[model samples]
Structures are given as structure tokens and as C-alpha cells.
Target: MTEQKLPAATRGPSDHTLRDQIVNAAMEYFSHYGFEKTTVSDLARSVGFSKAYIYKFFSSKQEIGEVICASCLTQITQRLNAALEEAPSATEKMQCLFQTLTVAGSELFFRERRLFDIAAAASRDRWSSAERYEAWLRETTVAILREGREAGEFERKTPLDETAAAVYLVLRPYADPVQLQAALDTAKEDASRLAALVLRSLAP
Candidate 1:
């Protein structure tokens, strides 16, 4: 009987390190050439690795895009959290969340349009990263709603899950890359107005 060979990813200098190297190289390539135009072969050549080696780490180009998209979303979430922390009240936190997301999305759409495209694809395809980000945003909004109710700033009549889901839908335009790009010109103003409307609806 012949013995089977193990994949490079399984016998490497930390799968994490190898994965990071490929992702970093891909990011650089994607930044310059855009995601749709760059192929796995291009990435493999750019990283000085065989296409098979690349495959050993990622199943498809979309998987690589997922990693990059997740990183970008993580940064936006970090900014949102920081803004929330600085806010003195739940009302302010909610406002902060909307504004921060708007600004972050706008920055990515304009400044890093290539990456934005990748994120847009991820959202459209229902990638795990996109789903996770949406979940986190909803959970965070629920927390804010709970805090507002406890502080007598918001009404408690609506069910928490329902309210949170509604809030998430309202913020979807800013969080969804494709929608965000289309609304870039009025994103900030729209976020402010929408947040105000949400606050009014939540008032005790």
C-alpha cells in the first residue's frame, strides 16, 4: 500500500503564520488590482507559493476575501465600541454607533474601494464574517436598548429581541457595503436623522 502525503498546512511553521502570510500578500495584491480581477494563480505567484499550496490553506478565493473582510469589519466594530465607551448615556451611545458605522463604511468605500468590493461580495454571498458582524451589531444594539430602559431613557414596552432586530434593519444600509457605497453622499446625514427617529421611538 502507498502512504498518502499530508497537506502543507498540516506540517508547517504554524498554520496561523502561513495563513497570515498568504492573507497579507493577497491583501496587497487585492489592494492594487482589486478582488474580482485577481485570481488564485495571481495570489500564488505573488506569495511565491504554488497554487496547490495556496489551496491547502484556503478552499477558494472567496475564503481569502472573507479573512480580509473580517479584518476590516473588526476595525469598524472596534471604532464603534470605543465611541460607545466615550458616550455618557445610552442615547449618546446609540447615536455614536450609527455615526461611527456610517463614517467607517464611507471611509472603506472611498479610500479602500477594492476591499470594499470584497466586503460587498461577502455580504451578498452571506459569508460567515458578514453574518458574524451582523450578529455582533444586533447584540450590541440589544445591550444599548437594555441600558436605556434601565436608565429610564427608553420605553420598555417593545420586546427586546424585536426592537433590536428593528434597529439592526435600520442600520443595515450603513453596515451593508453595497448599500453604503450607493448612499455615500448622504450617509452621515442619513445616519443622524435615522438615529434621531429611533431615539424618539424609544423614548420613555
Candidate 2:
């Protein structure tokens, strides 16, 4: 018999009542102690809830981390969308994508190191939040490429999917939490240079 695949882990408790209280308290605790170091028990204690009560909403500490990770990444994507909105052309949007990602990643790494740890763990463990963020990035890149090609600003020789995938691969260092930390020193210069090269290659 073929083995059945397990359902994906549930992110849990999206309401704005008790669940929000638990998550808000957990975020503060995680931000101070870091995600890997924070436990469900510790979170419960910090929030004045029993461990069992906390478990009622979240199955594990990782679940809470996933919520926090998703929130953080959502902020980055929001900023990216805003930057893209102000750009006049697809070329500017592509460039804005790189610059915004690098700046946002660096800000998280330098100013919110504890939160960054959660993102790094999410990336390392292939968490749902990270997966979703990556998918959004790829889709956004593909949209930009398609727009450029249609406008006669970019060449149409390369298949859209392949080109978008290649672009994402080049962008991974600045986008991945762990890799971004290592690339931080050169991230600005690298993003600018890479965006220029990608733009040049895309020219019709």
C-alpha cells in the first residue's frame, strides 16, 4: 500500500482575543530570550498562563515561532510592495526589490538579532512561513519580468519561469536570513551590482 502523507502543521489561533494576548506575550519573551532559547513553559509563565492553557492554542513552541516569523516576513513583503508601487517601470521595480530586501534583512539582522534567530530557524527548518515568503518572492519576480517583456524593456528569449528562478537564486543570499547575516557587510554593494547586471541582461 502507498503510504499516506501527513497533513502540514497547523499555524494555530488567529483570533484577536486570548490567542492574540498569548502571541503578543510570546513575542516579547522571544524577542528578549531568542526563539530557540524560549520554551512554551517559559512563555506561559511570562504570560501568566498555565503550560496546558498555552498548549490549547499552540501545539509547540515552534508553532508560536511560526506565527512570529510570519509576522516579521509579512512586514518585509509589505515594504517591498510599497517600494515597487512607487517605481516608474519594471526595471525600477526589480532594482527596488533587491535594495529593499537587502536593507530589510540587514535591519533585522543588526537591530533585531533575537527576532532574526527565529527567521534563521524558520529558513533552516523549512518552516511554512519561509516557504510562503519564498513563493511570494518568486511570483513577484515573475510578474515583474513578464511586465518588462511585454513593455519591450526586457528580452523574451528566456522562458519566464526559468528566468525568475535564476533571479531568485541570485537573490537568495540577500533574502535568506542566515545567508543575509553573512552577506550583510557587502549586501548593499552586492545588491546594486547584481541588480544592474540582471537589468543589463534583461535589456531587449
lDDT per residue as tens, model 2, 22-98: 88887788778888788888888987889987777778888888888899899899999999999999999999999
Q: Candidate 2: misplaced stretches above 4 Å?
A: 1-15
RMSD of each: 3.9, 6.4
List of clashing residue pairs for candidate 1: none
**Residue 94 displacement (Å), model 1:** 0.8
lDDT (CA) per prediction: 0.88, 0.86
lDDT of 1 by residue, 32-114 (tens): 88888889999999878899888888888998998898899999989898889999999999999999999987886579766
Which consecutive 10 residues in model 2 have the weakest lDDT in total? 1-10
lDDT of 2: 0.86
Residue 134's C-alpha lDDT in candidate 1?
92
